[model samples]
Target: MRSPLRSRLVLLSTCALLLATLSGCDDDSGPTPDAGSQLPEDSGTPDSGAPDASTDSGIPDSGAPDASTDSGTPDSGAPDASTEEPWDGGYTVLEEHGDWIDRGRYAPCSFNRQGDPSTVRCDDLSRYDLSQCSPEALAQLDAYGIYMTDLRGEVPRSDGGTGLLPAFAGFMLHSDGGTDTMNTAPLDFRNTDGGTFFIGSSRTNPITGTTLTALAGCQVPSPGIITGCYARCINGSFNRAGTFEAHRMPSHRGESESSGGLRLISESPVAVGEAVDVYVTKNHAYVVSLDRISGTSGGLTVFDVSDRAHPLFKASISLPGDSSWNGVWAKGDALYIAGNDTGTLIYDISNPAQPEYVRHLPAGQFGVHTVLVDGNRLYGMSPDMVTLVYDVTSPLAPVLLQRITVPEELSSGGAHDAFPYEGRLYVSNGFGGYSVMDVTDLDNVRHLGQYVHGSFAHHSAVGTFAGRTIAFEGTEFNGSHLRVLDVTDPTNIVKIGEFRLSPVNSIHNLILKGNHLYAAWYQEGVRVLDVSNPTKPRQVAHYTTFRDGDPGRRGILFEGTFGIRVPGDGHVYVADSVRGLLILNEL
Candidate 1:
């Protein structure tokens, strides 16, 4: 038997080789941001922070087409699936800079940062539901610079961290912990009369004057619907964030969990549910797929998996009115989750199977994205892109202690994932990269430093065990790579090394198991690495869960893959575009 140290080394070596092979994939460019109602007519009003009355909805306006989404052909652009000059081509724009730069067309959409302007063409915004099209319509939702709208198109499943949800036309698929697609529901972008859930550029934009080609040219979707996905596509600019069309989840009747087989599952659309997240105990694992129905309390599902090969249906718990949700963490007797719209929710999951709501703390923004509980306080990032600090000492009624606005220039008002270590908070500033802030003064978390070049840095994990901090910044469009920084001294941060694997450009979530770091490589797959040396990171073992071969019989169809940690377990939970939830052991 190999010693623990040798085992870790071997793991690192395997992960390195796999990462090397996958480092060649990609996120869509974020839309122009900050063009909120308060800003001047031309000045973009991106509201990545505190959504106020201005978060109201409005009729789609026709300014210079949404950035690079348009070609030089102006509003009367072509209507083909493929373009002759690449639609928005010739210009070095963000397309050339890879994920490092967010290139746009003329006027550069709303926020207008990328220097490249559309020659004259325009973007297609027809597929997104007018209601859900505003803020997120043009915004890049994931860390890998992947536009949330990307989900609007295809759902291609592959391996590593990216795979199709375990489903078959409105049905949830269930399996053991090996299921990486803990996907609750499909993005449901098919607002059309009777079209498929997936949207396509084949459709034409009736309003933008630009054709389908014009939209895809700039890497955007064709004009359409996004009831639950439209207008809310920018920072602080939420004209609409998508309508909540409650649909009863089709009841799934199949073999009981006692049978070692996979099943399809889904959240009841009409019923409110608790926040969605994953948690772990010494050797056990569980996923909390919560729901915050529009106007009702939420619910949760507890999957008991003492047997890695088989997860038993433990218990189901309900919480206060539909409290929207996100990231989840569990302490002694309580499970804490960032309830997107409901604030922070705490539940008693000591029973492993059955869980009960213990406490909750409302948040500033309507939804909470990422969260971290340090000592007695819980730190949450609201969808409005603000940091909300809560006092969790009183678990029942957690007090809202403070909320801080990230530096405008540094964070796009969007805070995705964050971790507090050594008197400081390290936040993944969405498209803004990784930021180190001094949260010692909770009320006033000072910006200690930042790593700005990583583009759409979605999630980060600090190697506290090794006294080192590492940022797994996601890069789409080929610029995606792992940026390792030396944060021993938060004030003076530096990028010591960047690990890249071809064919696998985008990286989502990562966790350090023992001395080896396992990462979810978007299209590439799951990667294990050796972080023995913080400054110099290396790869080890890699399992292409969804590669063409379909070795393990797990879902191989990969969509935009995202990743996360499974609490105390040595395994990691990777979220595939359509896959339900993937549970990978730390072997």
Candidate 2:
């Protein structure tokens, strides 16, 4: 496949060809033999009446053609087909039939023969039927800038009908009714040359002028000669940040990138904080984002919570990892991010647009998994099969107080996520039962307990609402399940209950606000669960944003919504694998 750039170039070249033909200006190669062929052999269907030899135009002699010819009355506006013969040998036959002959000085297919030499060269023949020209222009209608084999560029007939060229190489139409219309993919000059063509959002060939090159080496009527190249192209709007129009998404539904099948009610209109790893909270709002395609990493978005009617993005803090960001938690002005390889990063977003990096946690961790701020205690999971607890009573400095090593054999330790509550931290070990840890003392840690019934446990969240401890872990790889655990009694963590909100699975992340648990379910999308009861959770309603539409559409939901949380108000955010951060309001 030609790169997207090449394909677009071809399309434009073809369009130019169509325009040239309509304007009666054939390429220097002239039209094929019938177009400017001076030889008699090409004057196949010779006209009966010969052109008066006195005429300067060197048209082949076909006997005077019957006045009623296919190309219309011999008006000066159009070529005098009546007197022209299809043969190029200059012999005029008495037979009256449909044929055409060329009669002008020819221009060589002029081009920079050797790099940049000087002025282009020109020479020879003025007429040749499309079939008798150089392979460059002969079978490749696009060669002479002829868009299609059909006579579309022909002088518009008085009947308001159009003439069309023949399909690719089968020049002689076997019969009438054989023209392919524009509906079958517009002919890009490149594509007509058998090159692959790039399609725009509208599927129209968006080739521009400068990019199309006349690759004369290609065979006429053969594949690769015309189909224009389909190059891999990225969807980018020329506009830079702050200037991005809402039209950024594939409004026309063209081929887009691989997202979590979740549609963005609004794809991150704002690029920063896109991979929303940074969490910010204020008197007004909370939010996250799916960053931009540029830069090695994306960032976290902060919102103004001062007013519910309008939640504006107040700041964006970038993560240090060269990879995209994953999770974010903010305490006061300090923000913690799950930096891909750079480990957990702490930053002071007090100066948001210009964040000040504070400290970096240990490495070999992925996802930083999940983070929680309990007073001065900081808890986070490292993909390395270990969970770390930190004492951050000192704002600028965080002391790594403890690390509990969990055996990989005990838990896949795909140790996806963890969150601290009361004095215990609930850790969701991928494929491992949730592990409970006691961190009453930041420096001292103890295994409070664990629930070993295999829970998909990719991530977990703890909410202290109504004086009760409700811990949630995303278990269903593709369903909406707030794996509710009663952690009120930390020493004995129990999977008291679970609330399944939708048929589509893929429960990725969940966050509790007030009495509700905002679950970012992959294909099942984002749902608001009323978790007033630790043992039972119910969904109030759902906003069908742009999720995979339904969970497990194909036995498995590929549209992955990883992080879901409601920073505040009616807005629920979901980070999609395909689409960055999807911001939406609950219905």
Candidate 3:
């Protein structure tokens, strides 16, 4: 009995052979005898008779294809009829045949190999056809049915600048009739040649209610890996273009990576459903749980990790209405938690392990998505598009200072995360853009400059290197990479560098300590980069925390490393999507 893996490889090889022939056997080995076998030498009209001996297209004559003969036109001399049914042996062909969805844009964006714009207006996939695909190409598609891809591209703004954003996408080609669409998941059919592919989709943006469409041209460099260029169109106008790459999601019994310099010393699973972030203070670790999907209760879980090998769960705090806790930070003896229902849930962690809930600041449904602490200040991002500043001189009580309103356009998308450095607060205003604000005066917060690119900005970390203020920002979606920006002059911030893994791998939370940048990059796991040269960021080390076989690992595409922390403890603590709290020693 042939294993599934073996069967897929056979299909890939067959597809490669068919496509190679159709393309004139461009490989170095030279053309085959029947290189242009599909092309007819003549229609057999009286003027163009006898199979033109002078024709140099390399196509051989299959007897004489007499279009005018008494007998109807003969075969174009295609090989075996069985091969024509590409999926007869081991594949299932999709039956549904109809025009794919096409939402036309005035000028569609198209990108070049360097992730720069090649053409502002390009063709859509409507003119593309899978029926022209070779048998091998069909087999290759059957072997790689449904998969997810991470997309990164720039959205040209009205102001003449570009916004680089991350987008999550999937490709689904189903044998069943209903879902044959492309460009994003659960849909089907992108054009294919051997393993090279072109996938696209058109839709209406739910937030802005604007028309949006995406098209990607990709090639399977390996059996399960795809790399490509993507173009995005918005509101009937050409936006921008970028590059993308993805790997097939690992199977249930997937591959594994042993820890290297980063050694897992201790680990524990949260009793709550999804453990998102962790904060370590003194001897105890405070982990926050998010009650996502379908859940009524979510709260904080305390673990005593005094021992590096084993951690003990101490206490859990869950409120009736306030359950979705997303972010956590420690200042002195106080622990500040960002709550979706309640504002900042203040806790007295003077006793480290035993935390006592004090009060919720601003006191109501504030919808604080994330929180950051710097000295005596507390920065909380409210989803309604404002960063609420508070004086936390007294750990138990937080006095609200000011509400800095984000621009109306960005604020509509909500504020996702914030980072405080020097006198400037770098806040990711959801899909609004990246803003550098002057929070020096809590009385009157001012927006110094903004990096509005693309459509999404989720999290960022900043630092000063070589006399220049550099910001390392990462968006949450497919194709998101670490973008390095020189923000010394907030008004004219320039993009200096970028680092990317697979397009399907996303970047979550990142921390900049000294010259090393630590990030919890979704499926690519924990990446440690040395950004000494801001123009070029180099990855120094990595600790993979995602295993496909891990308990609740699904195929939603975003399941992997969720959070990371490096608090000068000589250890890196990560909250993995499935493995829970993982403690590692950095290299």
Candidate 4:
């Protein structure tokens, strides 16, 4: 599940075999980024200081069961289908929690020594005297107005900590002393479209843009700064109220931009459509591609990487009726390919180069978007939000053990991928959100908790860092960033830290090894971060994979590094959207 996180679907009638069209271009000639500034390291856990588990602060209580959903039931209905809507259908109306933002605490301006603007902790826009601003600053403000955007708040859970609510605002103050107007980005709360709620009239134009809210008590304390409380509540159905402070311009420009750690070790081209995901074994690397559209076929291309510097294209497999393989993984001699329409396609890799087709699991028209193999169990995540667990004790014949279902409320599009640790299953539930389940007992697989932010297309990687079970989750969307959550207590999940490049570049797959996180960031290329201190992730290295002038560059949103694998081989394998397989020395 890479490109915008969806199952590769093509009408069976239009299936046609097409050889991968190769374009001649210099892969090694890609420019490396210069060492950029680093973000301030943040530590310490957020003390869950909310009043109570069910703090009904003027907001509608989540105590009542939503009418649209089954009553707290798991595995109760057919997987919810997803339309093109970015929300993806499964949205939980945040229980009304009246005005949780503490304006006083964040109002006093305090500049950090590092001077990193984006750090909300150091975000203090209270000192500027708007009346004393120079004519130039005022003119820029009068024209563009002060746009204070990126208003993010938290939606507390019934347990303890909170879920992230994505919200932003814009305001324009008329210089003629006429009426000032404020507007909000369409808020989709738990699937409910809370159309642009009006924030109040106080406005200011800072160095960057305008900042204002509709909430009546808001104030333009000085100039270019607007402080006020805002809430989104619809007919007492949902509510998430918070205080926000917006500056005219973004504080973190260029602070998060950096390049360089990855050096090209080797490169190989796959004559396929969109080289999406790749998996590596001792002697070979298996790369998969997605079909351009529905009709043409896209299949697997194998390369013998035993010779690291010069990987030879060994064999190519293109099935007549079954293609569109989105993911690839291998355990022992069996290769598991995520068959979009035919469940899990198993191939015998006893002979690495020429893999023999074994069979498809759960035979029939089923879409397996991703596959994860742990010990003797193989977990297949289907697009319908159901995970089929199989006892892969025998490589050839996998026995279906049990069907693990995502909670009905959170199972919107389906389960994108799953990571297993101890007795728990950490799943990246596409539109439903991120979930932690006790797969300890398959029969009574209970859901512990979930973290559903505004962003859909949540794909992930989980690992233990600093004695806490931290999951590095990224969403594949225009503004998606890497969110670090402490899953030690799934019931009380806490967001410990976050990392981002440009909001426009989407994050795909993340591989966590020890204290290092290898991220395949679309457009930004391959990024390596040091997570030794999970609370504040630091970007130590990066390799830019996308070039605006590259040959066959489709200029699409989901273009760049699609898949990445770190098999403890001291090498990083990445699947670039245009460059095919890219091998870099481990940072």
Which predicted model would earn the best TM-score?
A: 3
- Model 2, span 455-508: residue lDDT tens: 345556665433446566655322224455656676666565565432222355
Q: Compose the digit string of candidate 1's lDDT tens values, residues 1-587.
A: 11111101222232233223321110111111110011000000000111111121111111112212322121112122114222221112111122332221111122111222332212224433233233433343111111212111112235544221110111112223232211122222321222212222211112212111111111123232121221112111211111111011110112122111111222111122322344454233434443321233434445545555555556555544443344566545556666655666777755655666676666653556666667677677764668888776764456778887678877653776676655777777765767888888875668878766635556665544232344434432232556666666666666665566532134556654433455665444556554444444444445443322222222211232344453333334444333335565544
Per-residue lDDT of candidate 4, residues 194-224 (tens digit): 2211234222212212222223113444454
Question: What lDDT score goes with residue 586 in model 1?
Answer: 40
Name the runs in model 2 displaced over 4 angstroms: 1-268, 272-278, 282-297, 300-321, 365-367, 407-409, 462-470, 487-494, 501-504, 547-560, 567-587
Best candidate per lDDT, number?
3
List per-prediction Cα lDDT, in the order shown.
0.39, 0.39, 0.55, 0.54
Per-residue alpha-carbon lDDT of candidate 3 for residues 476-511, written as tens digits (9 for 90 to 100): 554456667778788877676666655344567787
Model 1 stretches with alpha carbons more than 4 Å out? 1-211, 214-276, 282-284, 288-299, 316-324, 464-479, 489-492, 502-505, 547-561, 566-577
Worst 10 residues of 2 by lDDT: 41-50
At residue 422, candidate 1 shows an lDDT of 56
Model 1 earns a TM-score of 0.52
Worst 10 residues of 4 by lDDT: 18-27
What are the models' TM-scores? 0.52, 0.48, 0.64, 0.60
Error of 3 at 555 (Å): 2.1
Q: How far is candidate 4 from the true structure (C-alpha RMSD, Å)?
A: 18.9
Error of model 3, residue 462, in angstroms:
1.7
